[model samples]
Target: MECKATWRRWLLAALMAVSIVSYARPPASAGSDIADAAQAIHTHAGAHRLILLGELHGTREIPELVRLLATRYAAQGPVLLALEMPHREQASLNAYLSSNGDAHARATLRARALWQRADTDHDGRRSEEMLELIEAMRVLRGQGRDVAMLAYDTAADAPRNDANARDRFMAEVVRAAHGALPRGRLLVLGGNVHAMLERPGYAPPQMPVPMGAYLRDLQPVSVRIGAAAGEFWACRQPRPCGALAVDGSPGHTGPQPMPYTFGVMLERMSVARLIGRADDAENRRAVGP
Candidate 1:
């Protein structure tokens, strides 16, 4: 049976698991080479329903690249900016974006946030990055883009406190988000772990396979990309600046971090023109049906 979109009331609560770090990405199982991750995705031509940008948070480059890709893709068809936000704030998030007033939006967003708490919990001053991401989506909306928000997370009545519980909740959220989209149009920004393909060959297991694995079960062709380079600050781990191993473990050795916008990495990666089709002209609204 196909699961449909559904919403339930949720109370605002808990600390966001916003652990920003440098993510490491191994080569995918198969795909044509492209200049950048965006170009790589464009090469797929929206053939897949879910495209996961597995990112290690705390860098400007990844989000900028995501904005560019999301903007370009929106012209193709309906695109959902399915963020890793707690599902409890769906109403507040919708209201924040829909409001034209800056003051009102800020107040509302601060009230029920997905990342930073409204008060002085953990650097409440820096919700700007997340808000900016929201604005990027809003800008596309103003220009008549088929963009929407999916606060897909563990909407637990009480704060979750276990690895198994968190992983299970995230899988459920990704499945729900995937089911809500049309066949091939979900652009997800998430932890690299969630974007990995399941490998049953391993002895025990991949130790808590992420949401992307669950999503892949539903949409086998989902694309995965990682936004990590060597030399990054780890907010939640002992290795503050180090290389990330293939399985998300941190190490002391790796190549230097690229300073530019995805720098020269696009050479090895797929790089395609921003516009996928001629019909993606600027005047076209292409809102979701």
Candidate 2:
């Protein structure tokens, strides 16, 4: 009886040890990659109050990257995540973020006009991944982190024909949002064009001054998202909008140019799932006979 009891005790201890080892193991390789990437970005972003992450919208990677960066920044101090959404949707965003993130909250958010556009060709801003990023931010806020989101783009009804005027308006909105969170780190995610600190040589003489140019005094670190090759959702004018192949061989390589402080090259770019279609379907279901 004594021998059997001793053996059982040993077996139990071994099982507990194995359990602890398994529990202490690091995340999977994919997670490790994300963590490493986030660390690299954080290291590069050292001491900069504003980080302008210029991305080719409609990619799954950029939104995930933003979420990872936001999580990292929120851990250190306050963080403001600014998106290229219309300024008018700010109220709905606030409500959704403050809510419990239940189905009802999500449905209410999906009902917004931004996600219910009649056009089939979306510009990739209204993506399911973007909505998920917002939900992730809400999760961070729920965890008591000082993370806030801002829709800094011009109102939906505002005239968008003038690129120069639009960029200037966007810059002004960002400035006000940053001012509100004076001490917090600001992360602005928008189109690569708007984040350019200087006009590229290829741009036309009348090309509008980029939004980043207006905020030059802030010394924002503009990081352009590059990719080797893959696909993304974009609307080529006059063409039906859909997943477009990215031919990254020509211009994706080489050293970083002026106006961009750094570059993050995604190994493989994938199209972000457009949420507008899904939202439209849902809306139809809600009102369907």
Candidate 3:
């Protein structure tokens, strides 16, 4: 009995140590508030309701958060996932999901090909695609709930280019799908930048404002918004290693912010300053013309 008590004490200490180490490591931003937000929205939104989960593309924790939240609410109803990916790839993803899918293959499909096909504006690229979608599908399937994909983007270059058309498309898609499923739940996973009140800068100047706001007005059921933003810290490793301030900005030195979901204003402004410096140098070097 003495030996058993000693072993239990040692085991408890080890477990506590492991937890402290885990918290010390970065990307642990899955706060209780975020989970509570998910639960609150889940409780309010009806089976036919729409919920948006926005993320700063490069943040790895966001997708994991999505998976966690989705699993937490899997018992609600059939989740119909609407993505920022192109409509063309939905069939491919559907086919892949229907097959005896491997994790590696699903990852490749979600990461590699989907964005390449989805980017209507060649200038706009996704830094880190929502690789969580595939994983979420796997989780839902495991729980015996149906998961479907809907691509909510058009071939147009900018949001302004297809404002009415896109709105109509969303309405029609929701109407059609909701009619069929007994308890259809709509969930849109997109870059936090795009689903904002105004379009991001890389998009055409004429891009309309209030894309997400307008959608909220249309839905009969309540809507919920949850977001996660990435702050750049001094990462010793190739991938980001730690978190900085709660709401800090990324760097804009020799390393350009990869054109992905949304361009950080601070990074962009810094790059402009560097470019001005370079131009000034060239002017000084130039001889009388």
Candidate 4:
């Protein structure tokens, strides 16, 4: 449960990535997959304080897996869900969760103009799969479960000017969440890069440290699980490559080229309803199964 060894951590992440990517089906294989994954998560999460789950935004499996973990852990004690969503949405989420209306949450997203990313790239800002996750969360809370969810991103009052600044701020927010609930287990979820134990910085002139690395530095008890399925978009872009493009040069994106399905990356929960019919069709054709 306690992943003190570097190799053990890597092995866990690799197994999750492999299983999540290769395993297929709707209701059958998911049981074993979820059971195996849930057991791993429970082992670490039960003993440790923080469990970071790496997500490939638009995929359906990752968030369902997260819900599986939350549902599994809710009976034992307090389970706090730390989301990568903007901290600004905290109040709206609270209101939406407290009420039965799903419409308000959708409206809040529209008011923020956080809907579609097609203006920059083909990546969806929101996805239906993610909405399902949000609905699941709301339902869990409504069922009188001890599952609490919130956005642990950025310093509530600070002005983030760069990516690193945002990472640090988000790290602080996570640490704050931990401090707030010392008795509960924290389930942190975010994109692959943000959740990596030894994550490198985003873009050039950035440090090699990831947000997870910062949290690990603060609390070494954290366990990070990375999951991805098939090929998906790598980041936000104006044009659709429908695949990966790596910078082979020194101090760049990668050591080699990796394939992808999205022109954009990391769609938010609202994306399921935020995007237009045309965009959804394009996304489904490009990546969705």
Q: TM-score for each prediction?
A: 0.62, 0.81, 0.52, 0.65
Compose the digit string of candidate 4's lDDT tens values, residues 1-289. Answer: 1112432232222112101111122221344555565665576444676766655455455566777777777677777787776665566555555555345454564455344445334343255555556656667665666566666565334664565776765666676667666575788877656665564434345443467767765453333333222333445445552333322112221111211111111111112222433556675454334
Which candidate order results from sorting by TM-score in descending order? 2, 4, 1, 3
Indicate which candidate wins on TM-score. 2
For candidate 4, give the lDDT: 0.51
Model 4 TM-score, all chains together: 0.65
3 versus 4: better TM-score goes to: 4
- The Cα local distance difference test for each model comes to 0.47, 0.71, 0.42, 0.51
lDDT-superior candidate, 1 or 3: 1
Per-residue accuracy of model 2 over 1-289 as CA lDDT, tens digit each:
1133433332222112101101111211234444555666788879888888888878877788888889889898888788898766677777776777766777899878888643476887887668778888778776777777777777667775776888887787676666656576899999888988888888877679999999989888887876777888777757877777766622542236677877766677787766666555663454232
**lDDT ranking from best to worst?**
2, 4, 1, 3
Put down candidate 1 lDDT per residue, 1-289, tens digits, no spaces. Answer: 1123343222111111121222122211222222255564566544766666655543334555667678778888777776766666666666654555255565566545344322212311123445566766666666666677777665535454555566566667665656656443777776655555553344245256555555555653334343223322123334342223322222211222211011113212211111122332331232111
Off by over 4 Å in 1: 1-35, 111-127, 155-162, 199-206, 220-233, 237-289
Please write out the lDDT profile of model 3 over residues 148-241, one tens digit for every residue: 5655554334355455556444434433444444564666665454444334467666454434544545453322132333342222334443
**Which of the two, 1 or 4, has more TM-score?**
4
Candidate that beats the other on TM-score, 1 or 2, i.e. the better one: 2
Q: Which candidate, 2 or 4, has the higher lDDT?
A: 2
The root-mean-square deviation over C-alpha atoms between each candidate and the true structure, in angstroms, is 13.4, 15.9, 18.8, 11.8
Candidate 2 residue pairs that clash? none
